[model samples]
Target: MSLVELIAQADERGLAAAGVSCLDRCVPLLGGDDEVLRPLWASLAEDGDGWGERVAKIRGHACDAATGAGAEAVSGPRSGPGAEAEAALLARRMLAAVPAERSAGALREWADTCSVAALDIHRLLDVADDGNTSVTDCREGRTEGMPPLVTAELRRQVTVLELLAGHGAAGVRQALEVSAEGRRVLQAVVSRRARGRT
Candidate 1:
């Protein structure tokens, strides 16, 4: 099934996982560490307890990190030229927009939004043009000529949703693993960009 179809049929947990997975992969752009989003992943593994509190805590941390107040924050290429800064802004916006309510409807919307934002972030940072103007089109399955970064991101997003749908709560760990891999890739891209600028 297409990602849109998978998201439309997903349960509340699936939607939350999808959204969180997107944000988790983009953490590098927000100057977050590899494990910065672990609390959110752990919340997905258990019953829906303290989910709101975890999100709130992460939001506070993300805000502080963006402003260079958080100790865990690592300065990266996101502070560089136009595309890098824009990508960082999009990543921060994804965290800031997390909804307090974990309802299926709200999560579905957030998941859709995060998917687009994550794609946009990749497109901005990608060395090659993805050849598409609208990320909405890519999400809707029109992905010919996609750049490596965007293609990998789209694949990861779909994998995360499929894992959650097929395994229910059992999939959160695997989804998190997928996200971690993507985070490492983005971190390398950020590092490479930083080195190139020096």
Candidate 2:
């Protein structure tokens, strides 16, 4: 199903998880630890109020990490010039994208924005640099190419929304699992970049 159609049918819980999952996948861009967003996921799983607090904590951590002063030191150090500042800026945008309250409209907006932002952040962090270039080019009537990694991410995002639309609350667990898979993919990408730096 199309993202708009899926979002139009999602309930509040599905919408909330959709937004959180997007941020969760892009945590590495913030220089955040792998588990930093775990509590937010837990809150969604339990349908509790703790997600707000967890988001706050993550925002602070992301800010510090981007400045090279994280409480939990980042690995290998960001060697690219201005990369830290760029990561921090993207992190801020991610946090801001979270809806202030639970509503399908709000969550849909957040999810849509995150989809584009996460792709941009990944492109910025990718060693290859060509991964998302064609996506932009395609939009500009210049090229039809999209890197496989980016294509997979976009597919996963659409699938999550579709699952939520199809099964409502019952689909939450499956959606979370899909989000986790995306996170693992991004984590592997981060690790690969780290290894290449040495």
On TM-score, the candidate that comes out on top is 1
Q: Which ten residues in a row have the lowest lDDT in candidate 1?
A: 69-78
lDDT of 2 by residue, 1-198 (tens): 445455556677766776777787877666767677676667666766765677677667766765552223234434453443454466567776676555568776776667666656655565555533754442233434555566666677677777766776577778878888888888787667557657
The residue ranges of model 2 lying beyond 4 angstroms of the native Cα positions read: 48-51, 69-88, 125-144
Candidate 2's error at 11, in angstroms?
3.1
TM-score of 1: 0.91
Q: What is the lDDT of candidate 2?
A: 0.64
Worst 10 residues of 2 by lDDT: 69-78
Best by lDDT: 1
TM-score of each: 0.91, 0.72
Q: Give one clash count per candidate, in the order shown.
A: 0, 0
